[model samples]
Target: MRSGIVAIVGRPNVGKSSLLNALVGQKVSITAPKPQTTRHRIQGVLHGDNAQIVFVDTPGMHRAAKKALNKAMNDAASNSLHYVDLALFVIEAGRWTDEDEAVLERLKSVKSPVALVINKVDKFSDKNDLLPLMEKLAPLREWAFVMPLSALKGANVNVLAKQLMERMPEGPPLYPEGQVVGHDLSFTISEMVREKLMRSLAQELPYALTVETEAVEREGGLLKASAIIWVERDGQKKIVIGEDGAMLKRVGTAARRELEEMTGGKVFLKLWVRVKEGWTDDPKALSRFGYEGG
Candidate 1:
């Protein structure tokens, strides 16, 4: 059987997480419209008929990684390129930025074959409009394969999967048949809470906040989990908690519903927002929050 690792690299908000989810037919990474929604190197396994593809979903690589958190995220994405069977360089169709150029320059050093995945093609009404962009990028490098598809609309996604499957080296499955995600239960639970907070809070709030699952246990038929939402300042904490604790309650409810659906069991989740005061820039705090390269 064909089995290998494929790293998805791209600039922030280019739909890299969406592409990984579409390829795996499940949500292995949380996605948001905001940049840097993904903060870790998450893996999703695709168990096909004759191949098993371990797709690594990485944080968006970008410039000006001044903070400890951003540096760690950039490191996580860049580190995934090494020793992989294939690398999928994902980008949004009809748009290219300086960050994309930066990622391409970084990919030049990657020994693994890199495939150009032009995602979000469904944004355009006419397919022919993509030709100019394709022609422009064709000479940049000798890419292994180039496929234009939409991760959100599922357009040409299967074709991309088939192409990736063809390139995987022959071997046994990397993960068990039914296992789709690489993270553990606590990580998954923490991410769910973070995702809810990311989607609900203000734009800058997400960068200053993170979720940590403190305790998880089974009480009869229910799964009980308690987590702390760490913020960098007292003002941020108030915003997260909201007036009379409305915001926190809303986030907890949304996260608990998703957790229940994911685990296929009832979930009782407790969330408490605490002030950590610039945790994003503190190495010790970053390490405590599970960020690598801290």
Candidate 2:
């Protein structure tokens, strides 16, 4: 059997988390249209007949990590490269920004074989249009493998998976059969709730808040979960609660529905919005909210 760890590294909004979910055939990580929606290093495992691939989905690595939270995310992304069997350096089909270049520079120091994964190829009408971008990136490094695929639409995803499986070192399965995510149910619940908030709230407000699962219990075929939505100020808290609690209700409903679908059980979710006063910049608060390397 073959088993290995593949770290998926890229800039924000490049669909790293989406690709992980598609590969695992399950939603092990949360995603949003906004940048920095992923703030942790989440592992999604893919089990084949003779191989297991553990894909580490990391936060986008970018510059100007002024806040403690942002620095921690950058650190998480960079740290994931250590001791990895392979690294998938994912990028958009046609766009190469400064942050992408930054990530490339960082990858130069890693000993693992780095594969260039050109994601979101469906955005282009003609496949030939990708030639220029591919040619530009080809000379950057001796890439282990280069693939162009759409993570969202699953176009060419199978080919990418097959290529990755072949590169894994021969060994036993790293995780048990039928298991996908490495995180616990609480982490999943918190991420799902945060994803809803990220998609539902204003861009700035979503960055100012985080979700923490306080309690979880199962009773009579129902999974009951209590969580807190911590914000920075009273105004932000009021906005999250919304007029007559409409916003909070929407977030909770969406999260609960997704949770039930993911867990294959009914979910009783309770959410409360509270102020934590600049939690994003506070190291203690960042640790409390589960931001590693904070």
How close is every model to the real structure, measured as TM-score? 0.98, 0.99
37-101, model 1: which lDDT tens digit per residue?
A: 99999999999999999999999998989999999999999999988999999999999999999
lDDT of 2 by residue, 1-294 (tens): 999999999999999999999999988999999999899999999998888999999999989798999999999999999989999999999999999999999999999999999999999999999999999999999999899999899998989899989989999898999989899999998999999999988769998988899999999899999999999999999999999999999999999999998878899999998899989999999998889866
lDDT of each: 0.94, 0.94
- lDDT, residue 129, model 2: 97
